[model samples]
Target: MDNKINFKDLWAKQTSIEPNPGDLLLQISKMKRSNLRKLIVTNLMLVTVSAFIILIWIYYQPQLVSTKVGILLIILSMTIFLFAYNRSYTLFKEDINSKSNTDYLKELLAIKSKQQFMHTTMLNVYFILLSAGIGLYMYEYTSRMTIFWGIVAYGITLIWILFNWFYLRPKQIKKQQLKLDDMITKFKKLNNQLEA
Candidate 1:
């Protein structure tokens, strides 16, 4: 007599859990709202920071042309990033329930494409501009310090930037991609079930 049961056989015999379309749509709606809120907050923060930087520029009135250029670059980077980020705001504006599965899927695909662009090209541009700006901005102050302190300051800043670019950026991109891919996959499954 066989004492061991066939676990694979049992697993195969069990009915697959089918996700209800309504539930999926509800969850997607909730996710969209959450994302929209985050977007708004992030945009506001960027705007606020940009305004602060502008105030500093006006108040301090940096002497070197390079310092002014650095400030401009930083502001420009933030502006460009904000513009690209705002493009996704349309996804949450309409009622998800009003759209058919096909339409929703198309919209999701468009979102994925836009996300890829933002995560890759836009992020790279932003980081590059930001790094250059910081490097230039630090130059004036660091020059005033002793040689050792100047080197230390630049080294620390470079390390921080590198950490963000190499570590934090990829981690964030992966997290965003996974979340979006999960929703898309769930929707696709629901779509296929409907067609079948």
Candidate 2:
């Protein structure tokens, strides 16, 4: 008839507990598959857009040297980004046959490092090249419009770029960082348990 709660029973009955190794591994696998799918989709979309741009260039046959340069810059930026991004694919491919947790951890660390570089430096370069390319490309068409309309067009473009840079980019980076960090932390816990 004692009213006092038993600490042992309370602890034992607690529902919130750390994920088991099998569950953790399953989650990691699922995340990996999801990430791989996202990577493929992103690459495919970029390639399709590049092809569309090339088709437009061939069909429209822009006369201005600036227009040609602009198109080249856009395509070059996409190519560079894709190349950098795709290099990480090897890590995913190799991870399947990873011999040990240590090897998998190493791969995860390498991926995190690469993603940091992509999120920061490579992304900045891509955005800069894209902005410059768009500006140059728009000149040919905008030149035929009234000054006010030209200004409006440029302003709209600038605003859109700014919104993506200041808002969307940070949000996306944070989201991805959180996901990777969670997986890394969980993997580290599992690794420590194995080591101990």
lDDT of 2 by residue, 108-170 (tens): 666776776776777778878888888888889888899999999999999998997899778
Query: Against the hidden reference, what TM-scores do the models get?
Result: 0.69, 0.67
Best by TM-score: 1
For model 2, what is the C-alpha lDDT against the true structure?
A: 0.82
**What is residue 116's positional error in candidate 2, in angstroms?**
2.6
* RMSD per model, one decimal: 8.8, 7.9
Single out the weakest 10-residue window by summed lDDT for candidate 2: 89-98
Candidate 2 wrongly placed segments (more than 4 Å) = 1-42, 185-196
lDDT of 1 by residue, 1-196 (tens): 8959998998989896898999999999999899879988999999999899889889988889888888889988998888777866664565765788777776766667677677777878888899899899878888999999999999999999999899988888788778878877886787677678
lDDT of each: 0.84, 0.82
Question: Lowest-lDDT window of 10 residues in candidate 1?
Answer: 88-97
Highest lDDT among the candidates is held by which one? 1
The alpha-carbon deviation from the true structure for residue 133 of candidate 1, after best TM-score superposition, in angstroms, is 1.1
Candidate 1 stretches greater than 4 Å from native: 1-40, 94-97, 185-196
Candidate 1 similarity to native, TM-score: 0.69
